[model samples]
Target: MKTQVAIIGAGPAGLFLGHLLKAEGIDCVVIERQTPDHVLSRIRAGVLEQVTVGLMERLGLDARLKAEGLVEGGFNLADGERLIRIDCQGLTGKTVVVYGQTEITRDLMEAAPSRGLEVIYGVGDVAVHDIESDAPYVTWTKDGSAGRIDARFIIGCDGFHGPSRKAIPASAAREFERVYPFGWLGILADVPPCHDELIYANHERGFALASMRSHTRSRYYIDVPLTEKVEDWSDDRLWDELAIRLGPDAAANMTRGPALEKSIAPLRSYVFEPMRHGSLLLCGDAAHIVPPTGAKGLNLAASDVHYACEALAGWFKRNDADAVAGYSERALARVWKSERFSWSLTKLMHRFPEDGPFERKMQVAELEYIASSVAAQAAIAENYVGLPV
Candidate 1:
């Protein structure tokens, strides 16, 4: 098979890229190693910045999103019993929506067939070849059958553990990473949210977050040691901890329920430089990763896809080679900004084992400053809502 672009992975990044290219009359094919069901089953971030929502709108797949997504004007930061609210809309003239990443993926996936975007799922041993040349290809096997796609460009949206990023020679790239000592133990349940807006609390106990997937589906989390096991805490235990850490106001409205999904996700900040290696361009987790503290993971990926689409469009349609050559520098600028925001929020809201009296005081002082200063609030709101594309 031949195409202008071969996208590896059918997750949001890959799917978004495929749809964007196809919209511009550029032929692209998506390859996936997992079944569609498995891909949608993975739990992920629910917050959506304007950039993400804009992409959905551009693809004309936002009917469900606009109807169901919870529009949040602002969110709160908790210092024990106090809730310091940052008015994102007032400060930045923008707001975010509470929509699950799975829903976005489903919208894109469902719209693909109608829009003539082809995705090959449930393939194995997927690999990229000859990325150093103008002509590159992707190969995979399934059910004892082998398949190949020859393309002018191979996009590695296959994620951190996938084979796409590894295809780039180590000598041509640089990696930066910081693994946090604690992980977020989250619970997803079918119940009303405790609060109208999301809350990030930094209590003496630890860090806790109160969020929602919808009016009836609540998602909450608390930072726990990486060594802790999920089995150690039952549904009741986790709920109890959330109530205590989120403080009295949120606790009063909180409803206890059985866990629909519960697990511990480790936190990390990772970036692989030079997103483009010859004909292979990296997107989403293939190029970068940010902790979920600031809800930048999915939004960051959307921004990457937006840039990737533009670069590819420029290359094929306008016959501009510099756009492809400059893809890395362009994407990295926004990637680093988001990484900083996520890391900063994580530090402000989490109780680290290595942190002592001074660190605790610093967290308190910083939160206090943010609450009192509109300038401080604006800075956060700007990044939270996302920078311009």
Candidate 2:
């Protein structure tokens, strides 16, 4: 098969790109190693920044999101007994929407068939070939049959372990990574959320986040050692830990129920420099990852896609190569800012194993300042709602 672009992932990044390119009369194909069901089954963070929600609206994909997603005007940051609420909408004139990543993926996937965009799922051995050359192509195996797509460009949205990033020479790819010392043990339950808005709490025990997918579905997390396993945490034990970390109010209102999903995710900040290499450019998790503390992961991906879609559109629509040539530079500018925000938020809300009394005091001081000062709150609100794409 021959196309203008070959996308090596069916995740939001790739799907969004496909739709964006198609709207401009560009041909593209998406390849995925996993089945559609598997992709939808994976649980991910839901918070959508204004930039992301705007993109969804522009694409005519906001109907379900607007109707079902919860718009949160503010969120809370708790330090032991003290609660600091940051008014996101009041400070930045923007609010975040709580709609799970799975729903976004499903919406995009469902819309693909009607638009005639091609997505080959359950494929294996997907690889990019001759990316350094203008005549780039992708190869894979599907149902024991070999498949190849000759394309003008190859985009890697396949994520951290995907082969697209590795296709770049080790000498050219500069990677920076920091794996945290702990993980978040999270649970999804069919119960009302403890609070109307998300609450990020720092306590003597660890960190806890009270979040939700809907009025009836709640998602919560608490920090745990890297060695901790899901099997080690009973439902009761997890709830108890959350109550202790969340303080008196949250614990008292918390609803107990059987968890539908439970898993531990290790925190990390990772970025790969030069997001573009020849005809191959990277987007989303393939190029960068942020700690979930700031809820920037999916929004970051949306921002990358916004840049990429514009670049690709410029190339195909106007025969302008300047934006496409400068894709990496432009994307990295926002990527670094998001990285800093996520890293800062992580440090602020999480208890480091190595933190001494002085470090603890510093965290408390900063949190107090943020709570007391309107300027500090505005800055936090701006970053939280998202920087302009």
Candidate 3:
């Protein structure tokens, strides 16, 4: 097979890239290691920044999102007794929507075949070859049969564990990472949300979040040790802890049913420098990852792909490689900003048992300042609504 661009991974990064490129009259093929059902059913991030919503609107992908998504004007920072509202609409003149990642994948996949795009599923042994040559290729196996695809350029959107990032030479890339001592035990319950907007609570026990997926279903998370396992947590114990951390005041009016899903995600910050090499470019989790504190993971992924699409379009239309050459630097500016915001939010909300008394006191002071000062509130509101794409 041959095409102008061969994109690895069918997740948001790769799928959205293919969609944008096709709209620009660029021919591309997308390859995925998972079936369509798997990609559509996998539960992931749900928050959408205003910039992301505008992008989707321009692409004609907002009909279902607008119908099914819940729009919120702001979020609240609470400490059981005290509540401070950060009005996203008032501060930034923008609002956020709560829509599942799975829904976006479903919409993109449904639109792929109509665009004359090829998506190969259940593939194996995906690899990038001849990166230094003019004709870099992606080779893979489908249904026990091997095949090769040659393209003028290739993109690795296969995520952090895939072969995309590994193909880059270690000497040419600078890797930076930090792992937190705590992780979030997230739960999906078959109950209505307790609050109208997301509540980020800081308590002496730990950090807790009150969020929802829909009117009938809710999502919640509590900070726990990195070593804790989901199996060790029972439904009663989970609700009990949630009640304590989210505050007994709010929990009193809230009702919860059996948990539909539960998982633990470790907190980490990772970035790979120089997200491009020769004919291959990387985007999304393949290039960087931020803690979920600021809800930047999905939004950042969308932003990176938007930049990449513009760069690729310039290269194809004007034969100008300048945009392509500057892709890494351009994406990194936003990536680092997001990293800083996520880290700051995590540090303020989560309790670190390893921290000394001074550090712990400092964290409390920061939280108090954010709640009391309008300037500090505005800073958080701006980043939370999202920085410019």
The worst-scoring run of ten residues by lDDT in candidate 3 lies at 50-59
Candidate 1 local lDDT, 204-270, one digit each (tens): 9999999999999999999999999999999999999999999998999999999999999999999
lDDT tens per residue, model 3, 224-263: 9988999999888888898888887779867878988998
Q: How much does candidate 3 score in TM-score?
A: 0.98
* Model 1 stretches with alpha carbons more than 4 Å out: none
Ranked candidates (lDDT, high to low): 1, 2, 3
Model 2 stretches with alpha carbons more than 4 Å out: none
| lDDT values for all models | 0.95, 0.93, 0.88
**Model 1, residue pairs in steric clash:** none
Listed per model in order, the count of residue pairs whose N, CA or C atoms clash below 3 Å is: 0, 0, 0
Give stretches of model 3 more than 4 Å off: none
TM-score of each: 0.99, 0.99, 0.98
